[model samples]
Target: MKIGVALPQMAPGYGPGTTVDWARRIDAGPFSSVSVGERVTFSNPEMVATLGACAAVTERVQVLANLFVLPQHPVAMVAQQIGTLDQLSNGRLEVAVGVGGREHDYRSLGAEFKGRHQQLDDKVAELKALLAGEPPFEGADPVGPACVQPGGPIILAGALGPKAMRRAARWADGISGFSVRGDAEEIVKVGELADQCWAEAGRTTTPRKVNGCFTALGVPDASEALHSFVARYLGFLGPKLAEMIAASARASTPEVLAEILDGAEQAGCDEFILVPAVTDLKFVDVAAEVVAARS
Candidate 1:
């Protein structure tokens, strides 16, 4: 399994520079990739632009948008940006896209929130066509610099529901697991369903699966750390954040975290990205220990 670090783009008080520094630090360390999450109206900076800066500074680390909100942007424009980034990074770009669930974010962007699943599916198809060097629109110029790879950068669809998983199998190169809620049974079920969908689509090869989780290191108490972390970073979840905070608290210890990761690997996860719950770089230190042990 490959270990990656998620750059802190939405911490409580950190700025965009913090994300850059985190990317540089992770690249200098033993990580294979660095990821940034997307949030339009939230506190986080633009994912692709932040990652573009990271791509400029790093020579070896793979750059990823853990999941870009597909409903917020046009598919053609996203394809062009991703293709350019892939060329600029020498084929090191991997894009994970999903239909964002925040109603307020959609309202702010003036994008239709209903039927976003279908929109995401259509967008992914359009992106694939564009990356394959097809023209964005009928008489437009062909989108090129043509991705460093033959087709394009790896496209992973972030799917957390059954229908979305099937859509991922149909259109994306892989399915990103964002539904694991610290339950081993649920995690296994997610992997099983993903594999089933891929197979049902007549895909013989296993689709890549990526899992992500949040962590806070150097905290004396797991529950307190989890609560504080969610209260600050996941305020968008409303009151439900408290329940999620508690669930995450159960897996806070290093040993338990390792087991959780190992379970994911056993269930067919190809990569795991760890998001540090705290703003301090110390979580990276703890994550390094976890990676060393697991790898």
Candidate 2:
């Protein structure tokens, strides 16, 4: 499986300096992609802007938007941004769009959550058309800054539920899934359902299989560091829920991380995005070492 790393945008106090180092290191190391995620009302950097910066700096690694909450943005605007990013990265950009579950984020963005799933299905179709160089209206001009990737960059569904998977099978080229508990069984279950869904959708080829997890390593007390960092990042979920999530993050040691890698691979992950909880550059080196050893 191809391995990737995430910019520590969610880590408290991590900013442009750390992002640059992480982006360059991920591109130069034993990694196939560099990823970033979205959170509108949180401390994390905006997804498109951080990815735009990443695309500008890196030359080799695929730049992945681990997800964008689709219904929150205008479809035409989303198409334009993806087109620009695809061209900016020389066709290295891939995106995952989902109906985000965070209702508060929707309220902050002036978007509605009800009917969002249907809205996403509609928007994905519109995004595909716009990226294919089709004009929004019958007489309007097609959005330009043409994507380097023919038919634009590959799109993945940032989904966890079967209903979401069914909707995505209709348009997405792949799936972008996260393992909240970082368990291999989760990967296997998602993979099985994806295959079934795609088959039910009458797809001819295998949909791309990708998974992501959090890690807290390259520190003196890695486990504690991971829990603290996770709790901080997830503070939006309220203290009890955040603490519960942080406690479940187990990729603190090389052995533990290696186990996840092995399990993901065995479970058929084509790409595994490793999101680092620590901001130290050592985190990249250490994670790379783990991936290499597993390879």
Candidate 3:
């Protein structure tokens, strides 16, 4: 299985220099990809823009948008932006589009919270068509400067449940899954669901499977930082529930992290993106050493 890391863009105390430094280290490390996830009501930089910068600095690692909350932005604009990022990355881009669960983010952006499922279903098709150089359904001329990837970036669905996996069967190249609790069984179940969904859709090609988990290793106050970050990140879910989620993010030790990695690989994960909770660069070095030892 390939190993990847999340660009620490969403971690608290993140800044431009930290992000750039992270990108450079990831590029030089034994990592396969550098992924960025989006959250509108957060301390992170904008996903697409940060990815553009990452693409510029790193020539080897794949630049991935782990989840671009689709319904929050205009479809045409998203198409153009991703197409441009694809070009900027020289075909090294991978996109995982999803209707995120954050209602507050939608409200803040004036995007419709309800009916997002339908909007996402529609927009995925539109985005694909636009990337393929087809005239948009909106009767607008094709958006261009064309992607470096022939069919645009490999499109994946950021799926959290069966319904989302079903939707992925229709358009996505694969599923970008997250295991919030770092549970191997959960990741395996998700892979089974994706397989079942794809077969039900009569798809001959197996869906690509990628999973991510939050980690905080070899850092000062690692557990506290992990819990604090998770609580703040998922705070919208209510303090009690957020705490519950935070408590589950306990991969602060190399032993635990290795088990999670081994289990995920056994679970049929093709790639695992490790999301870091702390901003310390030492975490990267420690993570790389651990991963190298495993390799």
- Highest lDDT, which number? 2
Displacement of the residue 79 alpha carbon in candidate 1, Å: 1.0
lDDT of each: 0.77, 0.89, 0.89
lDDT of 1 at 179: 35
Q: Write the per-residue lDDT of candidate 2 for residues 190-270, one digit (tens) a residue.
A: 999898899999999889999988898788998888888888878878999999988899999989989999899999999
Whose TM-score is higher: candidate 1's or candidate 2's? 2
Q: Tell how far residue 227 is off in model 3, in angstroms.
A: 1.3
Q: How accurate is candidate 1 locally (lDDT)?
A: 0.77
Q: What is the TM-score of each candidate against the true structure?
A: 0.91, 0.97, 0.97
Report the lDDT of model 2 for residue 217. 78
Any idea what lDDT model 3 has? 0.89
Candidate 2: deviation at residue 73, Å? 0.1
lDDT of 3 by residue, 1-295 (tens): 9999998776777875987899999999999999999988877888888888899999999999988899999877888889888888889999999999999899999999999988999988888888889877567688876898886888889886888789889888899999877799999999999999999999999999999898988688888888888888888899999999998997888888999999999999999999999888998998998899997
RMSD of each: 2.1, 1.2, 1.2
Quick one: RMSD of model 2? 1.2
- Distance (Å) between predicted and true CA of 225, model 2? 1.8
Instruction: Residues 38-69, candidate 1: write the lDDT tens digits.
Output: 77777778888888888888888899878888
Pick out the ten consecutive residues of candidate 2 with the lowest summed lDDT: 11-20
